[model samples]
Target: MKLQDILTPDCTICAVPAASKKRILEFLSSLAAEKLVNHDTFQLLESLVKRERMGSTGIGNGIAIPHGRLINATKPIAVLITTEQAINFDAIDHRPVDIFIALFVPEEECQNHLCTLQSIATIFRDKQFCKQVRQCKSNHELFQLIQQAS
Candidate 1:
């Protein structure tokens, strides 16, 4: 699946005021829960935290893809956020992260999860694209830039 396919303007937020990694993940969980029916924000947060405990999703260069599986998810859902300030995310490169792309997929769709992660990684690998994402002034602008890139 494509980034544009899973990402919507409603799920794209810009200049968020999250001050820490945990707070950001909580914010993401709440946002994602609002979009998904019969989903609990705390449960979603647990899933993301569980994954984080295994390893940080931070891919460095101010980007982090925090993803998890949900038994109730019927399809993949993505949320994109940009913080006003970068926060420590325990990234492999030890750089603070500001851009976040959180994903939730059906627990059974392991292959789909990997493919989606690869697609997101490919898009974010472009330094110019990451720069454009960071420069976005509003949620609509950020969503538009991602759609245009995809």
Candidate 2:
């Protein structure tokens, strides 16, 4: 499925002002509530955090793909954000992460999750695209950027 299919306007966060991993994760976790992902926002946050602890998903170039699977859902939802200030995320490249795309999918549809991750990686591989994303000044701009992408 395409990302725009699930990226509602409220799910987008542009110019986020968080400065640390905990804050970033917490900020992302809170999106679950905003988007009505599930009843217990805490549970979703804990699940995502647990997955993160298994290993850092930050691959470098100021990008990170944090994702989690839930047993209560049947579809995937995504939240993309451009932080106002870069934050160290223990990325493999040891650089600060400024672009974050966190995803949530049902546990029964694991392959779709992989495809979503692949699509995000493939699109972000273009340095110019990443540059444009980092340059976005507002959520409308960020949403437009994503809409322009595959």
lDDT for each candidate structure: 0.94, 0.84
The residue-by-residue lDDT of candidate 1 on 48-103, one tens digit each, is 99999999999989999999999968888999999999999999899999999999
| Model 1 C-alpha lDDT versus the unseen true structure | 0.94
Instruction: Give the number of the best model, judged by TM-score.
Output: 1
Instruction: Identify the runs in model 2 with alpha carbons over 4 angstroms from their true place.
Output: none
Query: Which is the leading candidate under lDDT?
Result: 1
Q: Which residue runs does candidate 1 get wrong by more than 4 Å? A: none
> How many residue pairs clash in model 2?
0
